[model samples]
Target: MTAKIIDKHCAQDGDLRPQHLPQNSKTRQLNLFEKALVPQNGLFIFSAILLVVYAIAPAAVYLIAPVGESFLLLSLITICAVTSMLLGSQISLFDSRFKPSAPRLAIDRRVFIAVTWLIFIAFVLITFSTAPSIPIWTALRGGATSNELSQERGEFLKGREGAGIALLYISTFLVNTIVPYSIVLLYRVKSSLRHWAAAVFFLFCISFMQKALFLNLILPLLVFLAITRKLSTKIFLPVIFGTVGLLLLTTALSLAGEGGDTSNTRSSDYLTALYAPSNPIDYFIWRAAAVPIFTATDTLVVHSEQFGSRPLMGATSTLISSILGIERINLERFVFEHQFGGWNDTANSNAVFCIDAYVNFGWPGVVIFGLIIGLTFRWFKISTDIGFQSLWLIFAFVLFSAPLIGMLLSNGFAYMLLHGLYIRVDRHGT
Candidate 1:
């Protein structure tokens, strides 16, 4: 029975050996430090610490160092440190006990392919129906100005009421969730048609001129490859170069479309500055990490009375409000408005997940939120252990991991539903 299972996996993975199987009676035990360093938990722990450092450093410079003491900075740092440590400890503990085994059930390939094509076709139809003359290739290159694209997107969403709105949401969900899963599956199966399907899907998504959609698709694919030990240097290097090249091309296209003079020198300078970091820590803090923490701290100070007054709505504000027949208070939007006066049309106007929690509750909320996310990551790690032979598990882990640094619970429910439906143990196999 063991030999048969090994042969099956070897056939699927193209390389396996009997000696590679886990010993039945004497499985290798990892030490506490080694256990904590497992990739699934360790990466998140490192990220949380990095976020804390970024969050506290600027405040420490401005507040703590000058006067030698700042209670606010000290309190913020303590809360953040505690929250990160709690998360790390939870994740580490969960992963330490996880025992990997072969998957008992395989994906329903026919159903997966059919659903992918149907969704892709729906997306293509929607894009054309909404804006026929917008060349997808041009949009993919970022030739359309942000203003122009935003106006077009508004037109697409304008008058999408009742069933139309519902259909739009369903389509968006499929594109974001199932489509990426399908791509990963296709790649794993070594399907002859995978490349063509991926190209069509990429063009369709890039038509909207949203860089996130591209990253949302590609990053997961890369991570899935890396986790499965299938990522070759040839594939990895090209992907890196391709991503950088795409960004440069898109930036050039956006600059070209602007009314100002489009000079190659300006474009070159932009690329140089982006790659050649003078102050790496400061650059990362300013660009990525500090905004969320700063926003949360500002909220705590400016709107202390409102802090912790409401339940932590996470990401179900709209659904909950709809069901209860109440007005949905968009916490992120409220915070953004408070900080910047109003939403900026050309910029993404949402706070980080931590800030969202802090605003909804307070420091307690941050700790609870961290614990919940840590547990979710642990759940995925354990699920992967049980179904290590399944591509669906890999896809889920990659997809969920992408949003960890930014918004932890935004798509939490949707992902949970997907996992429940598709990734289950096979009673017969067991």
Candidate 2:
């Protein structure tokens, strides 16, 4: 049994798939970390299909809009994603080539610590700085208020003008995009208890309330997965109930006291950034479905024409702004924003990517792009052996949850080329 497993994993040229080793193999323990890092073919196909189904939803919505084509599209996409996942599982069973593994080596703890601290500190600072708040003054450091953001959009809260608030948006995107993503990358690589503690402290100091729940508890859930295999829901659920009960009590008491630290408005905090199962998970799931609906159909045009110049500013503004990027408007925005069109966003933002692909390279682009992304994510997941238990699984989750598919598509494209190039060079040198 051991010999057969080894023979199955070993390449003709004597290379070991860094991520995979058969369960009944003596070498299993030798490849622990590597196996964990490789992406899984099953997960890749599953997630990709989910994404595509989501991407094409807008087309579905129109079809099913009032029991129209929208329902048909949604059903089709869901079936496709699920079918692809099942098929990928069968493919992996027969194909040895797909079962590559990641390398296992302990990282330099000191360097890792330094990098992690830098990332955590930068993350805390950036979150606070960019938080939605009243822009007290432009020169002084504070977030732009919902009202000031409206003026910056050019049209008032309830007005319209086509003067193209392009510059304002470009500015907002630059700040919001760069800061949050940079922090995310930083958090990805960092591993330190002190750094985690500091994050908790900073989250506590922030008045927005929900920030603490996410950064302090949920985001760190990845770390728990990474470090331990002893986790069970038996130990998890009680804690959740306790925490919820505590929060509700505190909120009720705070409301009754009235004269408490009312500096931060409770209503705004509750409505704006509050973390609830319904808010993030439902948002992620429905938003996944919403993407295709928003992108492919004219349903959102009513809201877009209404926003006109400065579209996205506050909570309501951001929601509407997201709708603006759906297929038709995003095409206009892409063309307007970049002048030329590219088949970007095809796999990440659901229908946005498909529409972009259709516009740029026709049906060929859509099918090819979808297949490639779906395959790539699956391969990565299989290689890592992430399954549902690994910290890396969250990366896949986050990628799919993104408002746009640009990140996943571009990352896969760049990673494949770079990795392929490295392999070619190594082969030549050897």
Candidate 3:
């Protein structure tokens, strides 16, 4: 008999699914990395999704954003970085050095439950402090302006800057990654506590006031469920409807500008720079797709010219910034400042980590580190018995803001990932 993966959440479903051999099978058995990297593997599929966002999406920079003096150089650097990442991922598949045959630790059921409760309680307390009150709750009742609600819902501690921004990242992980992840884990085991987990998640979403929060919950959870369960294709209709509702919800949040005027288009640096048409659909297209590339490219062009061959090293990192007695604002804030030229505390030109990677170490750093990052993800993935881990979804988005190093060092993702490692979950409703 073939040995199945021994895992924490290694449910019967993961074991039930028949593992198909590669089409070009030979006498030699495929290694764990080879199996994990295959298209049919959920982890591989998740990695592909990340590749599109991190590696492929930057190409939009050339077509969308106007060229700057350093644009050509930055593009070349970006291209090289992407190439390095691609090569690195292939290398991980071909020659992964790790050999995790089983979970390194096993947690008791009672201890796990107690810890889960503690996490939920901490989430509620932290979310309450950050949001204070749900912005949308007041907005829905016409107690506040749409614009004010929109800003508050999006900002989460606009009062703080520099190293205080680390608090914002922590709160974000608690809301975006931790609480929901807890809910998913509890649900997978058919626990009644999942109800409480959902309540905390919704409360956080209401307080935070972004349509994307719900989509974050829905999309990844849906993908996870689809990967583990034999869901019918018909399941997508509700998701489509839910997504359309979310799109409309996003447009609605920004419908009114200042002075209670619903018709006026909101003044946004991105909307103005990208020259998107004054409509809802186009607004989303530009916001979600084009704007990230635009900001990333602008960062590359401006940063290269500003610093020349020298890199910031780790000045961009919050932990390093705190230690070095430097201001801890994200690198995106600097790019936004160069473009808009204000206090610039309220906005940023956020991009995937590679932009900062390039700024910090130039093309060579991006290449060498990109390979290392790919291997870490593959190894983390191969450790789990089940292919679809919820952390994969959260970590993908986290990488958009920071890289593996940044996530582990500063963003609090490391804590959240480590939190789940040994909490043994069961298929028979444990």
Each candidate structure's TM-score, on Cα atoms with residue i matched to residue i, is 0.65, 0.42, 0.73
| Residue 427 shift from truth in candidate 2, angstroms | 28
Backbone collisions counted per model: 0, 41, 0
- Model 1: weakest 10-residue lDDT segment is 1-10
Model 3 spans with C-alpha error above 4 angstroms: 1-66, 69-75, 90-103, 129-133, 142-147, 158-169, 258-277, 305-309, 324-329, 385-388, 401-404, 416-430
Model 1 deviation from the true structure expressed as Cα RMSD, one decimal place:
8.3
- Between which residue pairs do clashes occur in model 3? none
lDDT of 1 by residue, 301-368 (tens): 43444444454443325665666676665554455466656653333334344444555555666676
Best of the candidates, lDDT? 3
Which residue pairs collide, candidate 1? none
lDDT of each: 0.46, 0.34, 0.53
So what's the TM-score on candidate 2? 0.42
Per-residue lDDT of candidate 3, residues 1-430 (tens digit): 0001111222423232224212233233434433433323533554455456544544444456564434345455555655665566556452222233334354444465567668657755765665545666655555465547655654665545566555566655555555555555555554656555565565555455565665445544544444343223344455567667666665555543424323544434342343533556666776776566566666765666666646777667767778878765476777777665653555666666666777777676788766765654554454442322545555656666555557665545566545434333444324
Sequence-dependent TM-score of model 1? 0.65
